[model samples]
Target: MPQPAPAVQRSGGPIAPHLRRLLEFVEPGREDVCLDVARGRGPMPAALAPQVRHVTAVDAMPEPPARADTSGRMSTIEFGTGPVRITGDGGPDGDRPAAATTREDRVRHPIGPDRPTIKADATALPYRDNAFSLVTARFSLYTLGDPDDVLRELLRVCRPDGRVIIADLVRGNLAGPERDRIERLRDPDHPGTPSIARLTEMITSAGGSIRRLDVFTVERPIEPWLAGACDDAAADRIREALLDEVDGGPKTGAKPRVIGGELWFTQTWAHVAAEPIP
Candidate 1:
């Protein structure tokens, strides 16, 4: 049995550059109510909180053990229309003082307060129809067994004129199956990574009209990528496979290559934005 994927170590840190890129497709609005599915310990809620009216983050995974706060003092800020308060140590921006007068004030101080996060299943979301203007899931599809059901639920909760955004790592047409095999070796719970075409089909089949589709390649070092794997033996196997591929062995579909004496590989990420066809 494969061990669970390791918890994200950069939780609560500044928003990642890759996540920032994904947000471009989301285009959150000030009046929009957003729902982020399978939101792990990501900074999506905090990143979207200031830009949107409200953001509800849901995940099936139980909350991880809290890390000790090095900064002793705690502060609070008002979030959204409701009294959802964000509390954290060391001011809003880690060093700056908290401001509460206007939206501009909130935008300038993006790093304060923990937003609301609910533990829930994605296929069976606990929300009413047409509840949110923007529904999003990032890097979640490969973990789910029934992505089609999850997509339908996303569309079910989105307003008619609203957008449903999905982003995940994809496999190349020829290399996809082999890539998925390696991914499973690293994390047994991983269901396979879908090709871009397959993902688009799933969305369209689930009552979504594609508005925009973007595909980009991200290069990652093998060590950092394997750092999230909980199984040491599995991680070693993946490393060996990539190294073997580099030495002209069977292709692992990871497109592994050595860069300045370190092993590296590439991943294709696809971002799709769709609207519910009402």
Candidate 2:
């Protein structure tokens, strides 16, 4: 089985600050329907809800509930599947059990009082053509098995002239066998981290015209980075590899550095704002 994400760090909302800043490129407006693909609870939807008509946050995987309330002035819908029980005290979920969701299926999308969220795959979305005014995905492009196919789907669902914004760990140093080996160890699903140039070509080929590109780096601890890695061996292997890379004259692209005696890695991410042909 694939390993779970590293759990050694503090849990936070999914729409990271860097991602929120990327919003400037698209500059959402009122009367716009925004779809945040593969986006799990974060300030993104809540932030955009006021500016746009509605924001749909979709991700295939189920995530732990966010600690902070995402309830905006707009209506909300909390969606997922699991055992849902009502306490004797009347709560938001209800004073009654919902019979619509079968025991076998169990997967139920509960409607609530905030902006709606749904489960969906990036490549095969349930949305119709030209259904959204804006689409945003962060740190998802390079990890997919087939990024082009998913990118095309994102473009297809986007309205003509609508913007599709994506941010990912895109750097030239992330290429080559060494980087691939380390990434696969960290997350096997990670096919390859694409460079900015390569990502640009893919977006253009998928019928999108690039309008803006932003580059930034995030620093994080390697210990927490490997907490839920493929295995202890894989994690150890990656740590050793990173250490060796740092020891060597060429650090490659991983950008290993020591902070307060703890080892950290700098990841380069790129945000691209593009629009499909009208």
Top model by TM-score, which number? 1
Worst 10 residues of 1 by lDDT: 77-86
Superposing all C-alpha atoms, what RMSD in Å does each candidate have to the true structure?
13.9, 13.6
- Top of the candidates by lDDT: 1
TM-score of 1: 0.74
Per-residue lDDT tens digits for candidate 1, residues 1-278, read 52432222234565544555556557678888888765353456666776788887665343345898821111221111111111222110122212212211111112334433565667777788898899988776544337888899999999998988887777655553788888788778676788777888899999998877767666667776676676899999998999999899998887888887888776677778888989
Residue-wise C-alpha lDDT for candidate 2, range 1-278, written one tens digit per residue: 42332212112433433434555545777877888765334334555665678777665333336887741111221111112111122111111221221112212232234324565566778788998888887665543336788899889989886788886766654456555667778778676767768888999998888777766666666775676577798888788878887788555467787767877776566768778976
The TM-score that candidate 2 achieves is: 0.69
Q: Kindly report which residue stretches of model 2 are placed more than 4 angstroms away from their true locations once superposed.
A: 1-16, 39-43, 61-116, 142-145, 173-175, 249-252
lDDT of each: 0.67, 0.61
Error of 1 at 233 (Å): 2.3
Model 1: lDDT to the true structure: 0.67
TM-score of each: 0.74, 0.69
lDDT of candidate 1 at residue 258, scale 0 to 100? 85
